[model samples]
Target: MDDIMRAIFACIPGMRSPASPGGCLSAAFGGGDDDGEEGEGEGEDRISRLPDAVLSSIVSRLPVKDGARTAVLSPRWRRVWASTPLVLDDADLLPDDDGPQIFWRDVADAVSRVLAAHPGPFRCVRLTNACSYAGSRGAAALSRWLGVLAAKGVQELVLVFLHAWPVRVEPPADVLRVSSLRRLYLGLWRSFPDTEHLRPGADVFPNLVELGICRTDIKAKDLDRLLQCSPALETLAFVVSYNTQPNVRVRSRSLRCVLFWMSIAEELAVVVAPRLERLILWNGCPCTRRVRRDFRTRVKIGYTPELKVLGYLEPRIHVLEIANTVIEAGTKPSPGTMVPTVKVLAMKVRFGVRQEAKMLLSFLRCFPNVETLHIMSAEADEPTGKLNFKLKFWQDVAPVECLKAHIKKVVFKNFRGERSELAFLRFVLERAQILQTLVVVLTDGDGDHASQEELGNRLKPLIYSTHRASKCAEFFIFVRCGGTSWSFRTASDLSRSDPFDC
Candidate 1:
């Protein structure tokens, strides 16, 4: 405090050196008078008087309590925050020693005050409450707050509640009754409400565009009803867990993106999304032995027609994530499985003794139009154990002829330029007729500098050699070791033709 005061005093002339920082002496002597004069009439009234609209904008950006605190700055700001437009974050509620009831009472009081203070409809309202007690007191309290906001016609509303205990609670029906609600994210953890308890002939959310839910138990029929209510919904995210069997089908015609990480009890009965562009399925549950055990009933993965991004559908999907997990079983799948016409396909397999070259080869045969293919191996203490089989799989799968004309680019990360890598390259060089460029990067593992250089040297010969290279072979090799050295673009004939001519 003394330092600041002294700095301000030093801004005046003849108080300190002429080259004082921020002209401390000049500021101290003239700053306050200039500011006072500006506040009254002449000089700069624009700079002096804070506009009500600007104050409201500033308050609107800040949370409830912070905006209210700004009132103490000056007399002009006394009623500014009151009508700034409420945007509350319910996570601001923490356990107080005053007991849960009092705590909730205070919270309700604050919300009521803020709502009363702000005249117009709130732009954003977020009410999230967690429960420690078995009874849903917090949820009940939150319902009242949401009801108030709904009445005010808030535009954006988010409600997330994670309960430590399972409690039966009914949602405030009035929240859905809000006509002005456009975007909503509602998530309930621990348990969910009874689906049969829904209000009859209710269709409330007509203006909602984006609906996101997490850790919620929504039955199929109930979900379908909910989707039906939100006819204008464009994007939907359902982070489902546990054995949630949603029997009711959900169809979103306006939806462009759909993310589902849940377990559907029955096989995908209604996997139809006509306008869906991106479909992300992160199946947390592994395929049951009941399903995989029946060799006759080969699990057929079904997806929407127009899906551009589809991944992480099943566990032990070794063909999907070759970089992390390894392939365990090597079963030759029957041919004639119709492959969906998708632009991008990413696959990885869990590593095991039996290599899945045949299975992968069969799978790759499905993707005739795949433009890019990426393959990686798992990192393990015993690299030789599972790696050898994986290497063999790569060797068998890498017959350039298999990827000819279709695949134009291939990227191999954690590449060491080993025999497996060389064999893969040989396959590319032989098969990919329209292959424009091939990139092999060496990433340092175990801080081995010698190994990094060895990998780099091994890649250089493969790229520069003119023995038997692909017609469109343009190689690029990058050796990245500890972020110090990077050698990208090992071989390229820039003078001959433009690399990116297409």
Candidate 2:
């Protein structure tokens, strides 16, 4: 409800101010008789002096039911809500009280009623009632509702299946006719439909700027076609549960950010996304099981000259390819291997794994302009052979350009008091010349919390944790998964500049 708004009238600046007696109301919904009308006028006034644009903004910011209820406030308010683009989420129509829970049919009926009541031009519509579609009408097709949405000129939409579990059904051929969509999220799908066989230039998402697909089994050819059709799509994201095709190649003209969660791409080549800024891969596994699973992915950089923030890359499994050359542990830093545009980088390393530990240097060498670095301390269960990048290994290795000059902040996550872990931290403490802050997030999920100073004093015995290299550098520690866990929203959010932290 909070983040669903797309701000249709953002240019209406200089029109908003504090509300008067009639401008702001918490519970008044135009209920008054003789005495109540007098009280409502003075206490819950409906004579808002705000401009039409500002009134729309205020109404859009409120909850769906409350925003609609503003119509009962005054004649002017009714006109404003009727003229403004509607932002409807079905959850609001469902009652929150414990008195006689409404059936799925009731909720669906209420949603239909609301949509019918509103005028044309829907800013956004989130339909979660689809998850209960089967329970309500027994495999009823959701295309009917989609048609209604299209006719209403919805600019943003969140569409989910009406069934409890996912089923791959060919949606109506005219589904893409919803050309007014600016942002679309297709949820609970086995895979996105391939429209390659459609008639030449049948229909494309001309206005679609942001797209999200969740619970999908993504295929390369289909994914490529989806991007091609949406020529104006700038942000493309996916949250796949079981990825069948591990090889994906992206070629988009308008894409700026691409994020993946709980997905696997054995070989992903960025064929061409000139304006691409952020490429993120997060969450190793799909379902949370007690046992381990393989989640290896390799990335090939082709023509993404604008990529800035990248990672959660596991060197133990991932292969980094720049243009044509595959970056290896012994590969010397050169223009071919470097990406000077990257300002923030994240990595996943099991310091215990000899092969994985050595590849970190080669990966770090690729991003020379990285200012903030995040490292996820992967759990090493198998007790791999002797660690390769210990204190001695780090001391003798060639200097990492970013560590010596550009790196200002470093965050070590899921820290456990292991010998190999301390050795890596010690090396960074001594080598990083201008390090600003070292934030360590402990994996003490056992429900115990410790302060930063206390943890630093405790670590002094195991590792002289030199008080950071730079005079301005400081150390911080926190417990309870302080913004460490991953989610589809976190992976794709543009508001949060650094998803590595919050």
Model 2: per-residue Cα lDDT over 254-327, one tens digit each:
89888765555577778899999889876544342422356456788889999988988878667899978899
Candidate 1 per-residue C-alpha lDDT over 191-306 given as tens digits, one digit per residue, 9 for 90 to 100: 34444544443555778876665555666776666766676776676554334552324475666565554333343332446665554444433323334432221123344466
Candidate 1: segments with Cα more than 4 A from true spot: 1-57, 71-85, 93-105, 130-135, 138-140, 165-175, 190-203, 246-250, 261-270, 283-303, 313-336, 351-358, 373-402, 409-430, 435-502
Error of 1 at 145 (Å): 2.0
**lDDT measured at residue 405 in model 2 versus the true structure, 0 to 100:** 93
Q: What are the clashing pairs of model 2?
A: 22-45, 130-162
Worst 10 residues of 2 by lDDT: 3-12
